[model samples]
Target: MTESSPTVWGVGTTRTLRAHWALAEAGVAYETKPIQSRSGETQTDGYAALNPKQKIPFLEHGDVKISESYAIVDYVFEVFGGDRVYRPATSAERAASNEWCSTILMELDAHTLYVMRRHGDLKDLYGAAPAAIDAAKEYFTKLADAMVMKLPAGPTCLLSEKISVADILLMSCLDWAVLYQVPVPEAYGDYRKRMSERPAYQQAFDFNFEVLGVTHKDLPR
Candidate 1:
């Protein structure tokens, strides 16, 4: 690895998983700086200096500091993914990948999955809202139904024959759904199963868990 290898800071959450998985899929050598959110590590003045927003999954590559999980995935792909299997091969494929990522983040992750987490597992922290949880469940069920139709006959990528950034995004979101007990359509359930079996995915998972000293069971459920 060169001096250009990036450093990622975050625990074993879904957001951080995306960054780790993307870097692994891109075949990029990177380092981890695991920030313990529960212990207020991200709120420190030092970490705050790197990210004013003080979010987890912050990334440092060369002189660039990137926040947000999807942006980190994009950065890894753009900077290091030349001829990599995880990138889109054409303009149309790229557009499709972005579209899938956007829809999944906005509709499924932000609207449905996080809402469930806020109400269910993190209820003590965020204050549970029964009505909001119900509404989110309804919305997610519809979204999952639509995703089943949208997903290709996959044991493959979301948009093409090869994996792309979109697959990383969607797989992380689906993992969140399962962790948080969201009902997933059969198609996407199979999709998640297949993607999770990838060597890159396992590598990322192992790194996050080993560094953070947590397992899947340790996550909020």
Candidate 2:
């Protein structure tokens, strides 16, 4: 790989998938480091030197270094905007897009799905809380249903007809929710099916998840 080619670190998680997916959508050539979370790899001296926070989905393109998955996606589109993917063009558009991204990341991802992951799947490490998990699941359903209702009746994405980072972010969270067996709106199901068929998303899914011996079809829809 050329030194200037983008490098993405981490795999096997929805967050990491977002980074790879954005690069694929942009049709950018890049390299992969394939680190896993909680696997002691992120704690290594080399990785820690690259990112003190030790988060996956980190991107390094020349002098640009971004740790968060959302920021990485945003950076890619800024450098390589395309017809295949949508990045906000105006100040008002960017603000609205940011609103959708922030809500999805917080409401559907960190605030809901990860709550179940923490207290349910990783209970041995994070401790179990049946009540919290149940509450979180209910919260996810309510918010998702409400969000679906707000969508302009018939478009494949969250922000607009063209797929954007907001759509990718929301799609990743929705996929995570489905894997966790959280109830989601029927509109969400339709949107997920359509978005999953995107060639870029398909490529990213394989690159981001094939290392783990699973595919989207292997998981529940």
RMSD of each: 2.8, 1.6
Runs in model 2 lying further than 4 Å from the true structure: none
At residue 79, what lDDT does model 2 achieve?
82
Clashing pairs in model 1?
none
Clash pairs (backbone) in predicted model 2: none
Instruction: Give candidate 1 misplaced runs (Cα > 4 Å).
Output: 89-91, 211-221
Instruction: For each of the candidates, give the backbone clash count.
Output: 0, 0
- Predicted structure with the largest lDDT when compared to the true one: 2
lDDT of 2 by residue, 189-208 (tens): 66787888889988898878
TM-score, prediction 2: 0.93
Residue 20, candidate 1: C-alpha displacement in angstroms: 0.7
